[model samples]
Target: MTSPLSVIILAAGKGTRMQSAKPKVLQTLAGKSLLAHVLDTCNQLTVDETIIVHGFGGDQVKSEITNQYTQSSFTWVAQTEQLGTGHAVKVTLSDLPKSGKSLILYGDVPLVSCQTLAALKAANTDGMSMLTLTVDNPFGLGRIKRDQNGNIEAIVEQKDASADEQNIREINSGIYCVDNALLHKYLPELSNNNAQQEYYLTDIVKMAVADGITIVAIEPEHTFEIEGVNNRQQLASLERTWQRKVVADLQEAGVQFADPTRVDIRGSLSAGQDVFIDVNVVFEGDCTLGDNVYIEAGCVIKNAQIGNACYIKPYCVIDRADIGAGVDIGPFAHLRPDTVLSDNSKVGNFVEIKKSTIGQGSKVNHLSYIGDATVGTGVNVGAGVITCNYDGVNKSQTIIGDNAFIGSNASLVAPVTIGDTATIAAGSVITKDVDSSALAFGRARQVQKNDFQRPTKK
Candidate 1:
């Protein structure tokens, strides 16, 4: 029978360098909290259960994490005094079954992948295994002290190491895979006789060494994958690292980007063939761009589904809108929820479409507002047009039939409609419907009075 695997994540530290009241693990990296990334990878390891150790800002971290993943069955272990890493793990071990393997991780180091963890698990023995990395400069990190034959050795802290021990390039990465029973049996015996008076989990290797237990060390391919964050600089560095990875993934999946570094995708994006996304674009909450779509710079799209051959010009704010193929939306267009544009539609600059449907081959050009309106095919709605679909109390609808020509500066007050092939004169206020193939002129006639002149005072 295969032994079950459980992951223990140490995330209780309050990062003072971060300069925030939030816990260290709660700091966002790559649009997700550090602990969230750790737990996501842990799930891929087939981990039966996840146990988190919380200390500083324990209540805030617990409350936020619990709220974020309400359905997850994770155990919380509280070490009230920030005793140390060893004591943190000890607080959570009482809940474990004491038979399977326990993999220890740090939440601030959020980039660990499932492949690396699987490799470490495959290399684990009956004793204990440590994830080790060799660097050019092993300055402040703890050194891995090996034996004469180099079979097995102990992990020595930086402060406790002698001058000779400090020269070792191989450093322990603070991650381990160990048998649960052996780990629990030896963890309680760890002492705090050091200068800091804190229990170090690294000392467990020495205890295992004294008992003639074999220890294996595995190095991760990328050293940055294990770099833990204690400050803002490290957090920013890792943020760039993760963002590059995201960009690479999307590019590989055939998404064309004008500038890879300038795009930010906070949620899932589905792009069809020949979709062009310009710089400074942000897409969130499951956006889909169909084939031959062109999206300009400074666009923020959320929860939208755009169809093929559409042109979304610069600085457009789109959310919860569904668009059909061959649509053109503007340099400054705002598409609010439930707005649907059918094929061959044109919504030009400074136009706002909300809760409306624009039919095929319809054009609503510059400086127009269409709300709660249904516009038909082959319709031309000119500049400075307003639907006037609101009476300051409730919104109403204005429906237009096919081939209608609405002139410039026209105000179509709802609830009203214009029949097929109807024409409205420019600068008209249309309050009533016009019959098919007719003209409707609602503007009063302009009359110039010759005697209408201002008199000068005597």
Candidate 2:
């Protein structure tokens, strides 16, 4: 049987270079914290236990992670000192089991793919395995040294390396999969006699070599997968890199974009075939677009489902709404939570609908606010119309039946109903219910003022 896997994520570094009050692992990338991404990757693997070593902002990190991943089990170990990488892993040794393999991961390196990790784990059949990368400029990184016969040797850090060792291009990625027994054996013997005078995790390579244990090396599919964030500049660079990969994957699945670089997806966005998305469109928190859906520029859609052939004009903000087929929404419309639009419904510019249902073939065109209302089929809500649903202490509903006509500048007060084929006159304020096939006018009658003289200016 394959051995069980335990993951130890080192997040103890106090990132002074980042210049933020939050911990280094808590820095965000692509709308998620860096440590959150690492935890997400660990979820992809069949890990028996997850151990996180936190130093600075440990309480905040633990709280956030526990809240976010309530179902997953975690072992939080406190590393009170800012020690080297070896010391970080040393703190987690007591929590690990004795029989399985331990995979060491870094919280700041958020994008390491699960496939690469699985490969490294598979390579740890008898001894240890690590992930390495070949770069053109290997300065300030740990160089992977080899013997004359090309056998695996020790990893030399930049400060402790000779001129020839410093010239080596292959660098250690700091991700390792080591046997749990071997980790307990070698970690205790690590010495801090090097230039930095800290326990170097890379020194384990030399210990394993002396014991004649084979060390396997593997590389990731992309260079960005192992990139670690140190400052805001690196964080932004990796953000763009991650977004490009997301867009590339979406493009492969036949989604069209006017300009892929301009769009930002903060969460998962699933699009069907022939879907066209314009520039500056931001999708957040689980959005889906049906086939042939056209989204114009400068729209923010969050937690919404749009049906097929829907045309969404520019600058619309849709949140927690469901739009039916062939619906057209505005250049400046706001569809708040619990709003639903049926098939062929039209919502024009500057309209705001909250917790309302617009029936099929209904049109609410221009400067309207419909809240806590049910608008029936074939109904026409004219310009500048609003439903007075809230009255300081309570909220009420407005029901408009089939073929109802609400004229311009009309206000339907709470708990009111406009029956089928009913007509509400312009500029009227209807407080009571209107019967079916009836016309209601609640405005005051205009009287001539010819006899009254205009007031003189004081």
Candidate 3:
């Protein structure tokens, strides 16, 4: 039988190099905190208990985790001092169970896969196991040393390494799996005599060797999985790497991207078959695009549910909107929150829709502002139309019945209605309801002024 697994995540560093007040682990990647991404990978291993050792900005970390994961079964352990990695784990020893294995992870390293963790856990079934990687540049990293027989020996920190030792490419990843009982037994033996004058966890490797225990060293297939972020540059590099993986997966699922490098998915995006996305498009929050949907370049869509066969032209910004099938939207349209467009609706250039609903087969074409309104089916809202739904203090509604036709430059004041099949003449400012089948005219009548216009150049 396998022992139960527990996890300890180290997130105590102040991250001064990041030049921000937030803790290093709280830095964001792919719309979630870096610590959140590590926790997500940990969740896949089904560990019995998990602990986070937080120091600088610990309160903010606690509050954020509580808000984002209300149901998470994780315990918080405070490392009050800024100490080394070994000390961080030592502070959490009291919270760990005695009868299981403990996996040590770093919050800043978010790309480590669950499969690699499972392999580490399996290897630690007998004794200690550490994840190690070999890279071309090992500058600022700890080097791994082995004996002539190719057996594990000890880890040498970069500052303390000799000229020959500095040439070694294999480096320690700072991730480990150990028997819980042995971990508690050896943590007290760590010494703070290294160059940094901090208690180093690598010393435990020497203790394991002295006790005749074999330490298993496991290497990940990709070195990027073990990369850690310390500054803005590294954070951006990792973000791009993660994005490339996302784009590859989407491509495998039959989603077409005109230029995959120019697309960004900051949140969850789900698309059906035959979906096309152009360059420089950003999909944020939770978005679902149905089959045959087409999104043009430079569009930013957030929290939208777009139905099948809809075509969204370039430079549109949509947020919290629901659009139905066969809809055609603009090259420069903005759909704000609570807006809904029914099936076969058309919203054209430079139009903005806010907190409104447009019924089936309706068209709001060219330079219109529709807000706090309900427009019925088969209506034609002409160019430069505005729904005057606000009066400084409060907002009102403008309801247009089925088959209504609103002419160009019309301003329909709110708390007003236009009955079915009604027509409002061009340049009208409608302030009252119009009866069905009526042609309402509100502008001043045109008059010839040839005899009265001699007051020009004074």
Candidate 4:
């Protein structure tokens, strides 16, 4: 049977190096706070309880978690004094139970895999487990020591380590899985006699060793999985590292990127077979693209869906829009919230669509604003057309039936309807309904004054 599990995330550090007023864990990567990412990973484990130890900017940290991640449940413990990592966990002792295991994680180290964590938890069958890493340069990190028989010994921090200990390549990753009871037993024994004059969490290893408790050390599969962020430079570096992994996975899945380094996915993005994304394209929020979809350069798509065989041209911004299969969207189109384009439709350059549905095979070619409208199949909307959907006080709708042809520079005023096969003249402002196969013209009569003269500048 699996052991009951709890999580304690350490996020109390002030991160003086980051030079930001907000807490360090609140720093975002791929549009999610670092703490939020850790919480997301912990939620996958379905642990019995999750506790966060926050100190500096504690209230803002709690607020960020509460406002953004509504699904996550955590007991917040404020570390009143910024003592150390050991003290951070010490403050949460009351919230943890006596029997179940507790997994210690870092908020700034956000990319640790669920598989590695599960394995670490499983490794703690009887005693404590420590997550270690083997890096070429372990200069600033804590070093892991072992005895002659290869049994686990203890961890030595950089300042506390001797010259020989500092040469060891294997360093502590600062993540641990310990029995809750053992943690409670050993936490109070931690002393603040180190170089930094703070209670180091690594000291617990020596206490466990002296007490004859088994210490299990496990190394993560990848070095980047254990990387932490402290400053702006490191944050940007990790961001690229994460993007590289994301793009590589997509490449393995047969999605081709024009330049993998240039693409940014702030939230979730999934593409089907043969989907091709061009340079400088950003996919934010939840977006899915179907098979044979082609996204051109400089496009930003947020909370949208692009259907199969669709072609999206350069520099378009689509937000909260649903585009259907075999559709064509622009070099400079702006699709706002509540916009839907049916199969084979075209929303061309310089067109802005909002709260409207363009039906199957319909075409709104260029320089148009279609908002709060529903347009039928096979309708042709020419350049410089406007739906005139909004007034100062209220907004209304414009409806166009199948096979209707709206001329260039036409303004279809709100609450108007054009029936099937109707024709609207260029530059007309139609305010009433036009029947099927009928012609409508709402422009002023053509009258030329013989003696018209330009006014002189005053």
Structural similarity to truth (TM-score) of each candidate: 0.83, 0.94, 0.88, 0.96
Task: Give candidate 2's root-mean-square deviation (CA, Å).
Answer: 2.0
lDDT of 3 by residue, 1-458 (tens): 66889999998888999999999999998888999988989988878998999999999999998799887878899999866888889998888888789989999998899999999888874569999988899898899999898767899999999999999999999999988888898888788998999888888888888888888889986677899999999999998998898888888988999998899998889899999999999988899999999999999999999999999999999999999999999989999999999999999999999999999999999999999999999999999999999999999999999999999999999989999999999899999999988999899979887768666786
Best by TM-score: 4
Off by over 4 Å in 2: 451-458
Whole-model lDDT per candidate: 0.88, 0.94, 0.92, 0.92
Candidate 1 per-residue lDDT, tens place, 25-108, comes to: 999875568988888788777888888888888888888889988778888888887778888888887887788998999989
Q: Which candidate, 2 or 3, would have the higher TM-score against the true structure?
A: 2
Ranking of candidates on lDDT, top first: 2, 4, 3, 1
Of the two candidates 1 and 3, the one with more favorable TM-score, higher being better, is 3
Q: After superposition, how far is residue 122 of candidate 1 from its true place, in Å?
A: 3.3
Best by lDDT: 2
| Root-mean-square deviation (CA) per prediction | 3.7, 2.0, 2.9, 1.6
Model 4 off-target regions past 4 Å?
451-458
Give lDDT tens digits, candidate 2, residues 330-420.
Answer: 9899999999999999999999999999999999999999999999999999999999999999999999999999999999998999999
